[model samples]
Target: MMTLSAPLLALLWLVQVVCSAFPEEPGPLSSIPTEVRKYPVFLGRPHRSSLRQEPLHIQRILQVNRTLYIGADDLFRVELDNVVGDEMFYSKKRTWESNKNDISICRMKGKHEGDTLEMVGETVSGMARCPYDPKHANVALFAGNLFTATVTDFLAIDAVIYRSLGDSPALRTIKHDSKWFRYQLNKMVVDTNAGPHGNRTVLFLGSSRGTILKFLVVPNQDNTAPNNNVFLEELEGYNPECGQDTPQARQLLSLTLDSNSHTLLLAFPSCVVRIPVARCQLYSRCMNCISSRDPYCGWTRGSTCSFLRAGTLPFEQDVDHGNTSYLGDCDLLQESYIEEPDGLVSVNLLVLSAVSAFSTGAALSGLMVCWIMTVKHRQRSRGGGSGPGGRRKCEKEQNMLG
Candidate 1:
């Protein structure tokens, strides 16, 4: 039996990419085919492209550990200290140069809120040399230390968040062969759900090469030590081929997952794009849908993929509880859908405007009739031609004139 070598395997992967269908921005929902319209619109938001500019689009901004999201709301009753999280990011300038002084220099730092990144924090400077690279900083609210999740069996002391937590520290390391090269770690995103693993957390790490790493963030149940286990794993890979020959090739600078939409939005130097979780419906057959194990997808009647609901699936509640196996009963989803511009919303608005115009016209006509009658009454009073006597007077006057 003959097996393909690494180079041959890579070449085959590239070939598959060349043959794969390129992702196109989906058309307006109204224009979607009738056969496909009934299907749910998942990850494709109203955005056609990202909001970024050239020169402002720096690839270095998307480095791993360079950007990290720390959510305080996720922790239940964990204690927090100011000293542990005082400096959010490492000094980019200090890291590249040979400075013997054990101080991290950060010229720029900003706090992100909503759609704005405000430069509000004090300029972080003259900090003690952190044991680990700030890019690998992974710590929980329970403990303010930082830890880098790696596949290597042996632990790097400088990268450990907490050296000791009794028997087991609140840290995880996976012992496996390293498939992820290009250690220029680019981004980290924390994911939390409300189902069975509600207590458990997931981390999405973007590597410099072009891969997003998924890890189950293990926190210590008790105040003592954690379960001494590897927390990170290579769960899924969305490596779209960077075809050198193809005109459209993307080198990912950053990765952000919309927890609500279950969409993975990737930022490149010049532009941004998103991966729709709803495309799981492309699995038109029951066998393929179930085997794929996508949380957002379910097999429907006639063996077509159907979206169970909007947004990212709650792993334990939706997948573990068998929501992914839903077949038929699709009518229940009729009410829970996005309205198209040329569809329901426009029709409703049109009807409302027509009704308003009709009402205004009727009101004006009635008022004009009333005003004309009032004017005629006043004129007749002045002319004395309203009552029987006034009628006789008008006849006498007509006779006189004759």
Candidate 2:
């Protein structure tokens, strides 16, 4: 038997009450198998230059091949190299450094012929930039394009690797409107390997309301011009304990995707949650699954809607065009209620048929009435006779008794 002191038991009871007030959320669904690596390796931090006085906070990290790019107030490039049997090695290089004051000199260094010198100069510093904000925006480097989104704007820069900042023009810029868009976008993740052909760039945007907006951006397609940026669907990632019209906003702190697990990691202020990108279990039947139009889901064996696993064969999925007729037996959807007795089914079918017939008859009667009224209106307009009773009271003197 275990015994606790009075103060210890009081502490335990308080812990239990606090835990009950904030219970853990349900774990996300995961069907894919993942390999686990328990060994750990730590890399040495990069040495900072003496010129950098402030402490650094890494805002974003991106890896391309063996090179890792770290963005902070400044930018760094880390080269990770490991030869055949040697210990892993890496080198860090500071690619760009921010200045407290940016001094711009135009024609400052020019050749002087016969003692005349001209210079034009401008300098600015410490202007607030959204990209420099710690966690209020996101920057994505995908397929030679640089996409950046802040709370109030979105911009796409094309072929950023080839063009210098002085010459690279913005490909697209859209200012956010809260009145119409209804949410403040602060976090975004770009998935390049998406869609049926696996060549689309799909963006998952996270808003202050704990909602995610999924959309596709087709840049310079070969055949036709690209379409407008229309969101495919709005998924509720987290529901805040607040009204829709509340003035206070709950911003998403972090949003990232795990490609191996096919899940999204969403971090809010109060809690963290994992959401599977595709919820195939919501669809029960073949037609229903096919109509969902989710690329990550497919109708597989056992007549079940399931996540599309690698190397799985004979699955039915059509994300581009959700054609229910692809199964050739979608008529089963109409007769899915097979558990009912034959008499009950027949009676239900008769009632359904009667209701459908009555609806059609009522629609036709409405159209006929509208047509007759239109004709009477035209006749009255042409005759043009009016008194207390419009249309001349059908000629009162025509009654013989009168």
TM-score of each: 0.30, 0.39
Q: Between which residue pairs do clashes occur in model 1?
A: 63-186, 64-185, 64-186, 64-187, 65-135, 146-161
lDDT of 1 by residue, 345-374 (tens): 544356679999999999999999999999
Clashes of each: 6, 0
Off by over 4 Å in 1: 1-56, 59-186, 194-203, 213-252, 310-318, 321-402
Residue-level lDDT for 32 in candidate 1: 12
In candidate 1, residue 109 scores what lDDT? 38
lDDT of each: 0.41, 0.53
Best by the lDDT measure: 2
- Give the least accurate 10-residue stretch of model 1, judged by summed lDDT: 74-83
lDDT value for model 1? 0.41
